[model samples]
Target: MEAFTRLDAKIAPLPLANIDTDQIIPKQFLKGVDRKGLARGLFYDFRFDEQGREVPDFVLNRPEYKGAGVLVAGDNFGCGSSREHAPWALMDFGIRCVISTSFADIFYNNCFQNGLLPVVLKAEEIQQLMDEARGGNHVASIDLAAQTVTSPSGAVFHFDIDPTRKDKMLRGLDAIGETLQAKNDIDLYEMKRALSQPWLEEA
Candidate 1:
């Protein structure tokens, strides 16, 4: 997982509500478990026609929004079944942050683990940002250190994130990286336990 301390990127707007995991990457693309190659399948159904030709109208398919790292989406984003692949696909598709009015609990948690920032703002705030994102000249700035999102129209809004998750993201620490950070203490504990109970160690 990558760190997300601060990001200033073009925010592509996807203003549809109830965007479930299935609509994100689709089940047909779930055949592979690795996260790296999932970007090609992201929004497969919406991005392509039955003949696999690119759809011209989807926000992601538009030339102006290409390479956007931030997403301003509608309410109930990431809803439906709990599949970790949703965030995985998003990250692989170059989306480091998502701003929405609401999100599903499981998907929200998954975003934190995958180092994606899921910002939940009020409905009005979303509409405001949505308008800014629609413009071709706008870029959004998200500062995780300050818990602030600055829209292109010069409006600033505060968002809440778990302190632990924020800290982990700042340090670029995944669960494995976090555990390795306490490697010294773990090594000492193992050594002491082995000496204290040699029979258990052998068993």
Candidate 2:
């Protein structure tokens, strides 16, 4: 996982509510477990027609948002199945941060684990961000350390995040990375246990 300290990038507007995992990366594209190449599958249905031709009407297909790293979406974003692939797809597509009024429990945590910042702001704040996103090239700066999101016009909004999760993201530590931080302690404990119960180790 990559560190998410601060980001200043153009925002992409995804204003539809209840965007589930299937819509994010349709099941048909779930053939591979690897995270690579999934970006092409992100929002597959919305981005392509039945014949697999690019759909010009999709927000992501628009030229202005082609390289967008921030996404401002509607309420209940990432609802439905608990699929880790959703965040993988988003990250592969260069979305480092997502601002929304609400998000599914699993998806929100998945974002943190995958190095994607899922921000939960008030409805009014989200709407303002959405408006800013609609304005092409209006970039939003997100400071994970400060726990705030700032719009291009100098508007700032504060948000809350668990201190532990914040620290993990700041250090680029995922669950495995966090556990490895105590490697010495773990090794010592295992050594002591082995000495105390040699029979157990043999078993």
Candidate 3:
């Protein structure tokens, strides 16, 4: 997982609501467990036509959003199954942050675990960000340290995040990384247990 202290990048607009997990990466692509190749499968149905050619109508297919790292999306985003692949696909697609009015309970937590910042803002705030995303000269800056999202025109918005999760994200610590941080204490505990129960260890 990578640290998400601050990010200043162009925002890609995905205004459709009720975007479920299947629409995100599709069930076909879920056959593979690896996260690296899931980006090709992100919004698979919407990005491709029956002939397997690129669909020019999808927001992500638009040229301006090609390298977008921040996604401004609609409500109820990530609403379906609890697959971890949803965040994986988003991260693989280079979207470090997803801003929506609301998100699914499971998916929201999944984002933090995967080093993706999922912002839940009010509907009005989301609309403003969506408009800024469409502007040619606009850019959004997300500062995790200050917990603020600022627009190019100087508008600012505050967001709330759990401090524990915030600290983990700032340090680039995932579940595995969290466990590894206690390595020395874990080793000492194991040694003490072995000494206390030598017969158990021999058995």
Q: Give each model's clash number.
A: 0, 0, 0
The TM-scores, one per candidate, come to 0.95, 0.95, 0.95
Off by over 4 Å in 1: none
lDDT of each: 0.90, 0.92, 0.90
Q: Candidates 2 and 3: which is better by lDDT?
A: 2
| Model 3 residue 85 CA deviation in Å | 0.4
Over 1-203, each residue of candidate 2 has an lDDT whose tens digit, in order, gives 89999999988888899999999988977888899999999999999999999999898998888898998899999998998999999999999999999999999999999999999899998888888777754788999999999987779999999999999999999999999999999999999999998998996
Which runs in model 2 stand beyond 4 Å of their true positions? none
Query: Candidate 1 has which clashing residue pairs, if any?
Result: none
Poorly placed runs, candidate 3 (over 4 Å): 199-203
Model 1 agreement with the true structure over 72-188: per-residue lDDT tens digits: 999899999898889999999999999998999999988988899999999898899889888756689999999999998879999998899899988888889999989999999
Query: Where does the lowest 10-residue lDDT sum fall in candidate 1?
Result: 129-138
Residues 1-203, model 3: lDDT tens digits: 89989999878888899999999988888887898989999999999998999999787898887888888889999999999999999999999999999999999999999999998888899888888778885578999989999976779999999999999999999999999999999999989999998888886
